[model samples]
Target: MLLFQKLYSRIYKYSKMLFLLQIIVIVLTFISLDHEAIAELPYTSVVLPVHKHTDASKPLYSAEVMTSFIDWQYMRENFLIDIDATIIWHDCSLLWNKNQGDCPTNSCNYPVTCEEYPCTDIRTSSSYKNRYCPPKTNWSTLPVWGLCTCPVNVVNPVTVSCVQVSLNYDNFRFNESNGRNVYTGWDDVYPHAACAPSSSLQSFPANVTGVLALSSSPYALAGYLHKPLKRVLGLCLPSTLSTPGVLFYGSTPYYLLPHSDVDVRSYLSYTPLIKHQNSFGYFIGVNSIVIKKRAVNIPTNATTKISTTEPYTILRTDIYNPVVRRFLKVTKRIPPAKPFPPFGVCFSTSTKGTQVGLRVPDIEFSFPDGKQWTTSTANSIKQVTKDVACLALVDGGAASEPAIIIGTFQMEDNFLVLDLEKSAFGFSSSLLRKKTSCSNFNLTLVNSYV
Candidate 1:
């Protein structure tokens, strides 16, 4: 047993000596390696001097390079070289402890979690797979959104101006037709036809002496008369006869009444052969008439009777007298004016017997010479001869046959006042009644001289 003990002690002592030898050797080797590494490093001092920079002018080592060097040194000395030593050098500063949680071992170390770092969970954190880094701050510096939404295309707007005139013939015709017939000596003509202008006959031929009336009525008294006159002149007279002369009582012979604002009142009468269409035929016989102005009220103070004077002009002379004269000259006395052998008067009753009543066509008269007047300019009368000289030439005479004057006539005293209120408020028939009632008039004169 003693021998065994002695042997164990020797072995223990030998082991201790060997351990000391190993420690000395390790220290020497470490010193030698460190010295060699230092010697092997390029001389920053020499490089500085070559570049003509002093040690103070040389750039210092960067923190990243220093940290990398220190980490490599620690890993080599503590882990790779010392195989038996369990001590490990860990860079806790490099590891993220807040994101990775506590280190797995006491010797293990981790980095801290920065607020900018995108950590999934500190308790059970994960490594960044995409290596994405969050922005250091919020994006409050950006400009406002949605500022450019309007389209850049489309068009714009523009302006313009336009003038017009209207006339009423009913009033004009009525007024003219109702004028006094001084030559005929009829205060009002018989059958009242002489008192009204015939719509069928227009102008009397130039040679015949007769009273001519001008109307402002729209029924076209002159135009109506003209239509039949065209036929009559063609049938009854030679083509060589000159166009008939025209006379106007208040204005120039050619002056036609304007239709606007004229008062119209008249009635119509005719035989059965005179339809509305053929009614105009009735105006043919008396185209040539001396249009004269007769004083409505004869003044006792006047030295001379108001003779033909200003504002009264003869428009045309009657051609019917010459035709009759020619016929009488040939036959020794006037022949009947109708139903000649060649063309018998073909009377049509289809629209016949339609009669229209009307007032005299309105006349504008010159205020009687040297006399004061209270009425409107339209109502004043000037002498017919002074106003128009053409009246002096016409030859007045008796009718060849007892001529039947066909025209509309109205009551000399009654004037139509259009009751607009009645027109608007009353029944439609009331208006029709007024229209019909105002359309015609009739008067009879015996042995009336033309």
Candidate 2:
């Protein structure tokens, strides 16, 4: 009996040791697989929060640069953004140099040589006029005015002036997002852009260092980052200064959290995004304008375009007159106030206010395919004072080619996706009506996919 007991104890101990060895092998395999998965993961998308601020004169939308060239401490510095701009540019005069005692070791700015790819390629664009001039070997030669030494000269969309600047390439960082949560920073791509003098930034808001172009041009911000983004761009313009909206590069189900599993794209209505050969602006075909569900005749020849530079929509007199007449007729019951400059009609808001500004009638834009893009009273009317509100539409006097230019005010709180692949402009009219706003995107959520 003692011999049998000893044999049993020995067998049991061996079996126990073998079981632990199997557990160790399984755990080692799992760890190896986890490391490989992490190594295989490459960043797919870029996201930035679009900040809104009012200068002395008007509101401006901007984003900060996340790059190795700029000191992280000065991260508050930003770039003004224009959806119609054809190229990205920065004012280089006041940049921190490495020789400066306060400059960070990672921060340094330098221009690319004229012999480089982008600078060489700049000569090919007819718009640039081949203004690229290499640096003179001799110092005695008279400096040529309006010539680009190492970069190129391009027209500034905001000021409508020409800017001569140095060309630079840098790794621009963007925050990665899985729609539900922001993951990590991605900086693998190095895109080249122009750097102009600080004088080029006149009239821009203070602390704005550059301009980011979101136009359809091949050299625009979206094009340079297209490989990872898949030629998709999404923008949500915030209505207030306190809450910032978001700008993203990539395809989307656009999960703005708190509304779990809900995709904002599903709420969007798509229209064919038309590109004009002579213009960089985004245009769409509008069949007519309807006031209070009544169709107002719009000139068939007139074009409609969207703009972020313009604060309010501008309508050519021909289109404006008829629409305003119809609107005035509909709201004649409310007492008409004195005319405000630019705004042709005004009303006294002695009546109790509602969610959509004095409960005014909704204005609808009927499209070519019988689809409609409607704006509630919240967008159509602006309350300038406590007791007064004005019709936000401005008359552009008859010559404007685009009979209607929809501006940023009307676009606020709306989700817009410019899908280059589909060549479609998708819009979600007003997120406010859906009990959310552009500011609803949750930045603090921990992504399980991460």
Candidate 3:
């Protein structure tokens, strides 16, 4: 740890050496490094907002979004991200806890902008067990004053031990590029799960890739520390065709709703989250499908599960085409036109049906616990070519069972939450409330008392 601090100090002092020598030597090199990136360290304070087709204000989600490129092609189609985590620490002092120094308190900056981890609720919970970080002492002699951080190797419940922790992330996609590598020295406490770098994570062949092990789970950081909060993760998919979306840790979108101040219970729709393989994906049970408020005839054994295909549900492009054909047969809504060359059940935009091509009706999916998400036609029917618009569903390869993956396109303008504590998934199928500002979603303020 002392060596780690010295590296930062030297980098700070000889900042110019970085550009002049063009040598990129990271203290904690985690990702595939690019020589061009040797000029500067990855910036964590810079909040990145994913734009909707290049629009500025209308972004998908805004955060200290770490854009790390990969060498895969799983999520390239829908622009979906898979398996990420937010590492937060209480008491910036953790950076200096292992190794004390004579540097200025603020000079030992940890790159990312972080606030003290609130312990109000944890200290009060039975989980607290009187195991709290000692009260702050004025170590004025050292760079940082008395600070608390998660123990590097010791296993203390995050809420009680006051250690740095990671958040839960539940999307699955692969990036196949040589992007930037971001690292945080404060987070050396992970369980060190081994994950192969640069692998293609496609959403097909349901049983091809089993779930990731908890140890190797990148988002498992939440379970290590966010136990008191149940390790819940809330996400509101992009509301518009071009607008980006927002994701939250420790809280669900329903609890953060504009009108949820009173009865938050009424806003929750839950589905049992069955862990498939290990942590690879959350396998859900789809009871039935209803189109235009009418039930579609599904074979008895034809199973459906919601996988994290992101932007749109995923199935191999070939498999998706066949399902689209079956859906057309069941709905009898419109006749299929020429096949969309690349993939998908495409048709001419000029249909006898109303405004656009083969006007599709509302598709509703039933889940366990009476939870259901009805797709809105506007986002469901996608316009691909000048004269063609296909269903927004993603196309992947063939898997053993029929693929009925619930995608982000179907989840647009909706608030979804992954409640790790309860092992359930909660969501609001309604439109994203334009007035709701996640400012209150601040974890420090909410957990201040603990």
Greater-TM-score candidate between 1 and 3: 3
Could you estimate the TM-score for every candidate? 0.12, 0.79, 0.48
Candidate 2 lDDT over 1-450, as tens digits, reads: 999999999999999999999999999999999877755554445777888867825667887667554434434357777777666777643232434465455555545655557666664555445223332221111133322345466555455566666666544666676565676555345566667777878777777778887878776777777443577888888898888788888875687756868989889999898877645658898888999878977777788998877888999998899999999999988888887877989988766564234768888888887878888877888888777889999999989868899988888888998887788888888888888888888755243354
For model 2, where is the 10-residue window of minimal lDDT? 135-144
Candidate 3, residues 70-130, lDDT tens digits: the string is: 3321111222233321122211121342354543433232321112232222223332232
Model 3 segments more than 4 A misplaced: 1-80, 83-219, 224-228, 239-243, 252-265, 293-310, 315-326, 329-337, 341-343, 350-359, 394-402, 430-450
Report, for every candidate in turn, its global Cα lDDT versus the true structure: 0.20, 0.73, 0.40
| lDDT of candidate model 2 versus the reference | 0.73
lDDT for predicted candidate 3 compared with the true structure = 0.40
lDDT of 1 by residue, 85-107 (tens): 11111112222233346444322
RMSD (Å) of each candidate, 1 decimal: 58.2, 10.7, 20.8
lDDT, candidate 2, at 132? 32
TM-score of 1: 0.12
**Backbone clash tally (model 1):** 98
